[model samples]
Target: MAQLRYIYSMPVERIVRYFNDNGFHVNKATANGLLSKTADMFENLYTALGRAVLEDNYISCDETYYKVMDRTGNPDALNINKEYIWAMFAMNLNLAYYFYENGSSRGDVIHKKLEKYKGTVQSNGYAPYKSLRGEILRVSCFQHCKRKFLDLQGNPDADKIIELINRLYQQEHKHCIGADEWTQEDNLKWRRKYSKDIMKALKVALKRIISSPEYPPKSQMYTAANYMLGEWKGLENIFSSGIYKLDTNTIERLNRYISLSRRNSLFFVSHRGAERGAIFYSLACSCRLGGINSFEYLSDVINKAASLPPDTSLEKYRNLLPDKWSKK
Candidate 1:
């Protein structure tokens, strides 16, 4: 019931009424308790998911804001502070992990979380992402670059840039038609054969626009060109591996569920409450990615957790992961 409420973005009051109308006669307090306890039951599984994502060789990352209510004051008073929820997605494994850090979005927070991670991280050109340890290779999102020029549609230079970008997307679309059957090496060869020339042309066009005096330094076209040039190396890294995506669109789409929940629930009553939401979101989104029914997955796992000993091994908990559980 709690999973359904959150997954569907139905508020607790509505969920409670739904049960009462169906003759279950449950109250709001009972519903809230069920939701909290259910999240607690899945805490261990959430940790295992995080470890899996961090250990993977490639992942995408993004963050969104949530309003966390301040619990240090009067209960009736409105004391909301803006907090961030960070998401990390392992594409190859079909797993998603979410985390909260006392509402901090600092560079050190990222460094602390990913200090030992030695893999490619895909994200937008967030400044903090650039400060990641030398071991981590950062990949910039093309959609972000396109959006900058997309906003300046009236300019001829912006139009030309858009045309070139569309051509690149067209090549990607063609490659994607039977992408599932292609090996990583096959993908690499395809991109080298097709995408290499388009990217070279894009670089040349960006350089031409940057040198032209018609577009002022402060103009949107100039800024967009400079932005692409600055991220040119990271953008070019797409050719480095076929596993990397052209954009962080996968994780960005995953983040919309968090946005939807926030729109419905408004603010969590405490930091712990926000943490609980993170756990549920992680599992639910992973299940959705794996094409599993979240309610069945959660229900079975919660029951399995109840049957297991408190001192169960980490391997046992890992077996309950979405992908592993789906195979059963």
Candidate 2:
């Protein structure tokens, strides 16, 4: 039973090795078989997390790559497919939900998932997300803008960009009333007072750098300048509300497990296996965010899941969610 919990936190091969070291021999296939049999429980838990995230007023979207092993039609050929897993997290709710298309991370999946969403989305400058500018409030990631310049260290132009961005972050820190205590009204007022001017100055600086012939088009400074200028409108959207975050760092932090899992496990054997992995990780991370003991929560949910009808409505099991279940 305890070994089942480890599956979400580590690769199955590690779990099998741990069991073998402890005088029990288990194979990777058997470990995955256990997870596969409990697919209903994972799906139900993921559904609950999804519902919670969707209920929030602010969301952060981020994506990371995962590898999937694709069995080609030609018997002689084997292909390792590159796939993307996207996470849409609710900042206020401290919940996250993940999704992966069969093998693609294009605009269609973005459109389908967020079609009904109607709040500010904080993400890096991805064109698919940018396309939703009119449909939803698009807030750019400041960390992304800073990263572009950070890569060009020692360049005078890049240093200037980093310094200006740091100053803007300093204003945010200065205006924050207390640790996580700033109310929406106070945040909006503080941004208007301190951040608006910095944003205006940044726009001017970016335009001038981008227009200058001193740097070639292919140079990092030119690229950084162009990125910032192109994303200016979305970046300025930060000033529209105090509730909007400067970056998607919150959700990005949640991605460490997924990234680590990819590195350890290498690749999912099939598309269905990848989806199951997504479901398990979603539940585990959401539990961590909600301060629930995921092992206990999963045990309880698994017991309850056994009694549920095949077509159980996810809404009916909402109480099983980490936040609500933890209260019990």
Provide C-alpha RMSD values for all models, in order.
1.9, 2.3
Give per-residue CA lDDT, model 2, range 1-328, as digits (tens): 3324333556777788888999998888887888888765567767777877877878899888889988858556678889988888888877778887886788888888888887778888999888973458888988899999999989877887888889878888775645577787898888888876787778777888888898789977889999988888888888888778788888888898887778777888878877877777677777778877777777778888788887888886777776677533
Error of 2 at 241 (Å): 1.3
Candidate 2 Cα errors over 4 Å, as ranges: 1-9, 23-25, 72-76, 175-181
> In model 1, what are the clashing residue pairs, if there are any?
none
**All candidates' lDDT scores?**
0.85, 0.79
Candidate 1 residue lDDT tens string, 173-207: 77652457877788778778887788888999999
The TM-score values for the models, in the order shown, are: 0.94, 0.92
Clashing pairs in 2: none
Q: What would the C-alpha RMSD of candidate 2 be, to one decimal place?
A: 2.3
- Which model scores highest in TM-score? 1
